[model samples]
Target chain A: MLKESLSSFLRGCRTWRLWTLLGWLDIQQRYARSSLGPFWITLSMGVMVGAMGLVYGTLFGQDMKSYLPLIGSGFVLWALISGILNESCFAFINNANFIRQSDVSLWVYIFQVLWRQMIILAHNVVVIVVLRIVFNVKGYDHLLLFIPGLLVLLLNLTWMSYMAAIWSARYRDVPQLIASCLQILFYITPLMWWPHMLKKHQWIITINPFSSLVDLVRAPVLGAYRSQLAGVLPLFLL
Target chain B: MAEAGDGAIQVQCLKDINLSLDKGDRLGLVGENGAGKSTLLRVMAGIYRPQEGCVKREGKTVPLLDISLCLDDNATGRQNIRLRGLFLGLSSEQISAHEQEIISFSELGDHIDMPVRTYSTGMRMRLAFSISMAVEAEILLLDEVLAVGDSAFQAKATARLREISDRAGIVVMALHSSPAIMKFCNKVAWLQDGAVRMLGECHEVIRAYDQFMHSKEKTDA
Candidate 1:
């Protein structure tokens, strides 16, 4: 296990270059002949977040400014985590040629998919920044706490990337299952709705490991929430 | 490299293993259906890495197994060449300097600018053979690249191979034309049942193989 993990970590680091290339290649292949390209992702997020923020705010009786940033921040970070896990499963599947023929490191495939997610997340980051600026949301002034939290999130995603890729490599049905799970997680998590509103049933949200991750980013920035028990389960699970 | 594996390559449709490229020599391989030519060539390439023993390469080696396999279809041939070249043990700087020469040699035209997925099989072979030819490794492992394309293209490739040989590089290839093999290869090794049955001068071994096959044909008749 140690040897495998060591090799995996090394290969994982080495694959960063290959990951960038493949992510770029995938994006190019997908958007070829299109002008809007990545901006399409931007446009879709804008529309979805705009519509979601408007509907959920009025329905939940929350302030629009406070609610939009919460939803936007929650969705953005959750998507980053879920996106890495969701996409990591298909990394090796799509590159069957390289897996069978090319003898390069296998971990490179996982890195490529995760890197691609990071790219899309990067494009969506504009939404977060825009939400912060437009809604007058205050970000954490404590860079120390923020940095470590982001590090934990990044490290956790890396683990998920490995697990997801290996699972998919073994079973072809995994990627689809993961996609559905992400959809369910989005609904179950307090992403569109505020966690505090579910005070009686808050255990469901608190038990969620992602809620910890979500609060790590969402609470500090929104200043309305602090992770009391949301992160404990996942921190221990990890 | 990891210790070799015990797995054996099972033969299915191969005709028979029977051929050789002599010691310290450049050889052109030629044979027909069930001739076991390419399979035998792969065994010789040391790709399978038999669990028992090893295929020795006294010097650097390069195997042009399949031109399409030679490059990642997703990457530019130029970029693919760099990684492929390094895998073949060419330093990055050396690969960089030789990039223009290899692209020019393949005569792939402007298509080299695009991903190899855009390339036809013949074009892939041309690029592969050209790059391997340029690197001129000590031992060249080939798999029937000569007949990969148009006749004119074949002539250009053959001439290029000839030029490669002139530099004292050793070539081991599989082809379907005995005449082609006889024209270029100095020696031959006839393989049967995954073992070398005969190894000597090309014309002599091929002649013996022909006569033996002919007598068997007559007996069957």
Candidate 2:
């Protein structure tokens, strides 16, 4: 059974063309009949970052020039990670019909969710770029680090999705449970606040896995690698 | 094959089953509702796994258990055909090769450009049947899909099935109509409560089955 399942998982990965097409279909069907379609997410993300940057920078007494870009990259990457993890829970359950009738692998559905989330992440990239330019965010030439960071984050999320898919298949309430946990994780993570602000409570940032994951992506984009050691160390260990 | 629920309660949909077939063999499955006929076909097609036993099958098997195998109603009929063909292990080139054939066979000219959800049930069935028939498989497992379509289309589908079975390596079908059994199958397996009660030549087993059903109905009356 172990060998069989492993081969099936591998086979699912091999059918990239199939899952890629299905992923596109998923988005097309989701926003069917809508004028804006999936671009709505990109537009909304842009508006959200703009509004949050102006208000939060003033409340925290920080200059919008640097603070806006930080929050923008953090939130955009956070949305991608959380979206992949949350959607993974329903990956297998949603494909019950295809699973019961066809010989398609279970991993195909998980990959579909991953692929769809990646598309959304691609759209969210525009927000990050616009904020970087608008705020004149300057950093070291470690921009290449962003590629590896994003790839590692994606790798971790892929396995996490598979784990969630397995556990959620057995427990019907797992998806809801995951959603609530992510809700709490979102608040605790440093998406909205700077980690330096919590100097004494720095353990909150170190102990939380989401903090590490967010830093892996955000530190590269923002070029704050020295302070992101707490995030990078754990990811390297993983 | 057993679908386990909660705790120790396991509903064994099929058990103590053993059967084999060779090239050009057509086996008809007859059973009442929930007697595991469809389950058996799925087991044969490798869609379901049996806990106690294993099924060893050679060659590709096309299972027509559901006509809308994975049809996206949100997608146009042409897209649906392409998607369904991909799921069936066809390459883009192969699907493109058969695209014209399937479209013409379904007789959905301009309608093929429309989403499948816009098509009527019969139209969807036609699209599914056309796409399914276009694929070439050594083994075919069908579950009462012939009961689809209007009388005319049904006749046409039956003839197509006959032609495919002649060239296919093996054909296993779960059906309710005894006449369909007599006409299409060479062997019959009668299932009762998840186990095979009788298996033999189509005529002999079907005759015994008819007699049993007749007497049982009279008694119930």
lDDT score, residue A19, model 1? 57
Per-candidate TM vs. native? 0.74, 0.94
Predicted structure with the largest DockQ when compared to the true one:
2
Model 2 lDDT on a 0 to 1 scale: 0.85
For model 2, residues B1-221, the per-residue Cα lDDT tens digits are 44455553567788799898987888999977899999998888888878887899988777878756568878999988888888888889999999999999888899999998888878888888888888887788888877777888878877777777788578888988899899889999999999999999999999998988899899999
Residue A228 in model 2: shift from native, Å?
A: 6.2
True contacts kept of 2: 0.63
Let me know the DockQ for model 1. Answer: 0.18
In candidate 1, what are the lDDT values of residues A138-192, reduced to their tens digit?
6456423644666677777777777788889878788899899888888888888
| Docking model 2 quality class | medium
lDDT of 2 by residue, A1-238 (tens): 8898789889998888889988989988888889999999899998998898889889999888888888889889888988998999988888876777788787888889989988999899999888777767778587668787778778778778998998999887888999999999988899988888886878877788778778877887886664454555555454
Cα deviation at B140, candidate 2, in Å, is: 1.2
